[model samples]
Target chain A: MKFDFNNNIPIYIQIVEQIKTDIVAGKFKPGERLPSVRDFANETKVNPNTMQKALVELEESGLVFTERTNGKFITHDTSLINFYKQKYAEELTLTYLKRMYDIGYSLGEISKQIEQLGGNK
Target chain B: MNTILELKNLNKSFGAKKVLENINLTIPRGKIVGLLGKNGTGKSTLIKLINDLLTPTSGEVLINGKSPSVESKKIIAYLPERTYLDKSMKVAQVIKYFAEFYDNFDSQKAYKLLEELGLDVNQKLAKMSKGMQEKVQLVLVMSRKADLYILDEPLGGVDPATREYILDTILSNFNEGASVIISTHLINDIERILDDVIFINDGKIILHSECDKLRTEQGGSVDEIFRRMFRC
Candidate 1:
């Protein structure tokens, strides 16, 4: 995984958002064992404490769970994953729309442009 | 103890000149803290005081609730701003010397790190570039299983790639429950790895804050904030 961090936001928050995006995009398989915090921190080139905080945030959201001696694993709840996927899509769409509007593009124009781009893809 | 290091009402002066004034700080375990300032801002002086290299005119420097002593030296591994190793010593000999000098030094880990960095053990310090020597020093320092590692300007004068390697070595090698204090003027390169930051200016601490909270509150990177605050 690659991280292009924006120092304007908290590092751990950025990691949490990136991991969430990865989970919803199927980059990390459901129920797959997560790497140890130290390994993950090394991979991300972040502090271990920041990585631990991100994992704790993920756990709080039910996307990750810890097994005492075994380690952390991604949730196997497909419904929850799908729900997050939809929510993420909505967020991206809203951001795109807001940017387009700021640049003087209308809702109709955005739909037409998106449809054209999607067709090409 | 929970607090790995503390300073209370610390003050230092040289003759008529005041180098540091009325400083107080506390550092908890398992943290990476950045001591940041412009050149000649007493950053080195503060670090020296912490390491007991210089005596404070007033106040106390405490490690694990005790004053700086042989006990504190045992738990704190220090990397000074200048290279202190013998230039005539080969890398392997240096490792052996460190192993004999510091009880907690791990020669195997040092060798592994040296191999990973592609540094030849037989190469003398004088044969290597300044950056390479600094890397060797960093590898040795990280190999020690110390509770608190105090690195002074570890990233200074190194290439970008070497800086990344230095940061990676620090991140990967520290023991659990240990804390690291890195002093540098280059904030952007090291800010991401810092849990907290201490900003000193004119012999006083101007700001001390958690990295994430500071970023969020100030709406900028630590480097940006430092530039803005210390603008000429």
Candidate 2:
């Protein structure tokens, strides 16, 4: 997974987001071995410890699972994937609504705008 | 929260320099304790004494109602300011050694962590950079589901991003009913996560209070109160 070091977010967070994106995008197929922490760290030029943290977060969130001696693999649970997708989608929508509301957009106006822009995606 | 560790009138001095004095503290189980102190204020010394790496010159320490001993060592997972590891050993070897010594050691967790860290069991510790070595040490320490985890300067001298990751590791890991005591002057980053704090100055515990109560009652951050109490 590619990392943007200069991003305003923390590197571990960036790593977490990237890995989740990969899982969501099917770049990491179910049961596929995730990259070794050292390889990921070396590739990103970040500390292995930092990389490990991202994986731990992923594991905690049920996006990945680890098998001793074998290695870490992407979780194959379709419901779990949908769970995260819906969770993040709702969060982003709420955040966008908040931002728009802060700029004086009413709830009705925002809802109307979403309906107009909904088909393109 | 059971009393996991207690210190009574603890005092320490090196030559003419007094590092800590009249330090009394009781660490309860299942809380994140933040030990705040500036450089040379004896934060590390306090941890060393608890781990029995250094004998306290004065006062008493009790782990599970007895003096710190081999049995107590079995229960505590200590991460020192300096990495105390055999650099010659491979990452897998150290985990095995820890597992052998500590019956509570979880091999599956260790292997899973190594996999997550992307560390090969065959990789030599000496070959890794200092930062990698630090990660290895942390992974080993955290892999254990110990009762009391003592971390000294867990984020010292690391890049900001790595520091964030280290903090996350501390937060995400550890077992239930296990208390984690992190000693560091980096108050701003860890203030939010700490359940309680003990501020040390000249080897004495000048302030001891719950972080939330202190904030709510005093209407200030731990760092602000720390600066006020420590102001020269």
Candidate 3:
């Protein structure tokens, strides 16, 4: 729950991104109940308002839902979760490729290097 | 009222010197606002005016749409820049004193916080270090069920680790819909918790903005913006 926040960016947006990563990575199980905004804010060491905004953003994206007095819960849709996972992987891959290209490495060379690293793993 | 506090054409002076000038601001409920500035930049003066500690030369200081009076004072918990507890009183005695003095003061919550901080209730104020005393003050202030909490430099004397604890205490405590106004020169440490920020310089408010919008527009942290704006 520790956040090494970048102050240059909006704190709530960072919270949304981190929580989204956690959800997609299975740290927060599908259909799991989330903590109250206050408890979440305390855990993340952020303002409750900021945490509320982040949760609302998550809800808007259909990753979370409110059940009236029962509080918030993660969506049980495995397909939605998988979709986000794929989307995030694509984003990371594109970023890596862009950086490699900027450093004068071709896509072929980058793939070879990644394969070598993966083989060692 | 929706607005917890407001200032209209606020001005203050001391003889020939103008300490605060033509200031106007409004604070809504359920917000944590940072009143930030360099030393002697009217931050304290603005806070003092809100607390009725000093009279503004003109304009008005409104708390819940009323002037600073006994009614407003009851709902506004104030932690001044300096410690004013009786030096001879033990921590427990001070809690008792505060309980008797302020109706909203929660002695049990105060004791719990003190225990968590590992501060002995029997310890006298003079026996504790300056940082420890400040922690005690913060615990007491946050223990109160006040509508608006005005903390002046609560993190000034504490170390970095203690600063985190202090910020946590502030974030966890406080009644819902209550606003907190924290004045500090240590911008980076407190900026994350602030919903809005008021930047003052040379007796005037240079900027007041939501922290996220300001970050997006200025392309930096509030600390960086402050440093750039106030650079000599």
Location of the lowest summed lDDT over 10 successive residues in candidate 2 chain B: B211-220
In candidate 3, stretches whose alpha carbon ends up further than 4 angstroms from where it belongs are A119-121
User: Which model scores highest in lDDT?
Assistant: 3
Candidates by DockQ, descending order: 3, 1, 2
TM-score for each predicted model, relative to the true structure: 0.95, 0.64, 0.96
Q: What DockQ does each listed candidate score?
A: 0.79, 0.04, 0.85
What lDDT, from 0 to 1, does candidate 3 have?
Answer: 0.94
Score chain A of each prediction against the true chain A by TM-score and list the results.
Answer: 0.92, 0.82, 0.96
Off by over 4 Å in 1: A106-109, A119-121
True-vs-predicted CA distance for residue B193, candidate 2, Å: 1.8
For candidate 3, the chain B TM-score comes to 0.99
Considering the two chains of model 2, state its CAPRI-style docking category. incorrect
lDDT of 1 by residue, B14-125 (tens): 9989999999999999999999999998999999999999999999999999999998998999999899999999999999999999999999999999999989999999
Tens-digit per-residue lDDT, B1-232, candidate 3: 7899999999999999999999999999999999999999899989999999999999999999999999998999999999999989999999999999999999999999999998999999999999999999999999999999999999999999999889989998978999999999999999999999999999999999999999988899999999999898
For each candidate, what is the lDDT?
0.93, 0.80, 0.94
Displacement of the residue A2 alpha carbon in candidate 2, Å: 22
